[model samples]
Target: MTLPAVPPISFQDIATELRLLPGEGLSFSWDNVKRLLGMSRLHPGPISLSDFLGKTRPWWGLVPVRSNDIVGTTWYSWNQSDGGLAAAVDPYFGNMPITAIMSTVSASGSDSIINFQSDPGFRNNIKAQLLDDNYNVVREVVLTYNAQAGVQWRSATLGGGDTSTCLFIATGIFTINLIKL
Candidate 1:
């Protein structure tokens, strides 16, 4: 959605407003008050999802989740408590639209086993990659929605027993209902 055009407010305008005396009274409107307090500056305006995701750093806003749904659920491997496979089993997460991208680097040279995670409930495209120390992609796989198997987590073992630090990245959109499974 397009945001309404708001006239740029200058520092001089703010200074004049601050300088107003009690007898003179304040001329600022509610919108002006919001602008002066930097509330309006917090939003960068509406942006397309594709463009938003493409950015190195994207701005996002949180919306209230369904009361029945679990809050703060994430799909990260390191999050052993409430994340990773645990989040996948939450009934509320089923059929929930999820767009996530994450990466991690192997800590040790002997780290041949890299654990990857994705929303098992995803119904769209998912991409997983293994990259070498030089940022060169060693193994890459893109999984599309499948009716038979569906999208599941995948793992890649580095060949040649080579164990230089490697980066693993996964990006996907998942929307599956656990009740159906």
Candidate 2:
């Protein structure tokens, strides 16, 4: 006997797995939402911003870019023409000189303090950071790597608001970080 065809999952079902970077006025799913109420034991209350944000860790790392139209707390537009990270999958923040991308696995030691070195010749552009939930920039640090050499970048564990997912967002390009140990 022939087996019946399976229905494709709708976008809504899978959409929960996806989340908009914080601060972009986008919606997100609460994994804790269902689990909190005990699955079927009791009806869950609306996840108040306070409850959800009660105590969380800053999510640090890179996430997928939904659109070239999203312009984070940066000077350049989504379609960064000149100063932006180039198109590259293996590693983000590619060929584009000033664009940002998630940092790729490298020989460089992890846990090494991430610092942002600025190019004085061109202009002053700060690399901003944001939380994973709202993509809201919590802090702005100037890109300065004058005295300090090697790969330049400023580093910090995403704080402010909730700290559940401490993902990092950058202005120059997307950068993924990891602890060396």
Candidate 3:
């Protein structure tokens, strides 16, 4: 005899494995949310006024823009036209954490490559770092903004172990994107 068909599991049910509920927001104190996404809570940063404030909420969005469309301490507009980053504001000032639903694997994972970006002509020394759930430094790299260099992005690789058991956190100025390839 054939067995009956199975219904697809709901998002809430799936969250249970991560110890989450249907309406739970990710936190720097939890694992499930961090595991599912590479979101990390940033420390408070300094407050400043700049043109970056007008930027949209999502890093990659382009429509119906509003200042309140804000996403945390960072002014990340969902839309983006330049590759500088999704958020234009200096996240360091807010001392806030950058959070995202990160990707992962059970074992034998590739390296975690982080990319940093900035204006081509600004002279600055940016301190950037990547961390794991235990708050361990996985990798660290600095991005120098020298209009001459036009080095919009500086990338460094870290961690090749199984990601199934840890959460990776990205911190610093510019945009912090974690990727494994």
Candidate 4:
């Protein structure tokens, strides 16, 4: 089955560019959390998943922030009992696409690994997996996001080919850095 072109990893929203804290903190914020929360209220009634995901605001605003970090997913749950802060990321990205082009001959050998960028405490069992165009899980490799050694490596091989592209999805709030390897 052909999936719709996965909407460009939404990075903008309806919020005016004028700084919410105008004249200060002048930086492009990546805040999908705040944008998705108000989905139902904005669209109302029934809507297709694609339609909802496709909604583009004049611009999106930041989710609640704390100590200078974007916080909480619109759907997942977490906790910060002291100040009661919680965060989750889009599950859609969990199923983000990967392609053969994401492979490097180095990671293809037994001694090398795929590099998945991560911080020390945020990830557990972080990984990289190969998928076919149909989204079937073809192969998976558990990544060790070792910040101490500055290494984020996972071992997985999808043989060799180049006629098509698949996904090299990571296990967290994925950043878009599609490149041929």
lDDT of each: 0.30, 0.29, 0.30, 0.28
Runs with alpha carbons beyond 4 Å of true place in candidate 3:
1-88, 91-122, 149-181
For model 4, residues 30-148, the per-residue Cα lDDT tens digits are 23322332232233335334433433222111112122112321111111222221122222223221111132332222212323223223334434334333223354445443455
Q: Find the candidate with the highest lDDT and give its number.
A: 3
Model 3: per-residue Cα lDDT at residue 152: 34
Candidate 1's residue-wise lDDT over 11-127, tens digit each? 334434333344554433333333323224333444222221111111111111111112422222222232332232222234233333222233222121112244444454434
- Clashes per model (N, Cα, C within 3 A): 5, 42, 34, 14
Query: Number of clashes in model 3?
Result: 34
Estimate the TM-score of every prediction: 0.22, 0.22, 0.24, 0.26
Which structure among the candidates has the greatest TM-score?
4
Give candidate 1 misplaced runs (Cα > 4 Å).
1-53, 56-121, 151-181
RMSD of candidates 1 onward, in order: 16.2, 17.6, 20.3, 17.0
- RMSD over all Cα atoms, model 1: 16.2
Give stretches of model 4 more than 4 Å off. Answer: 1-121, 156-181
Candidate 2 TM-score, C-alpha based: 0.22
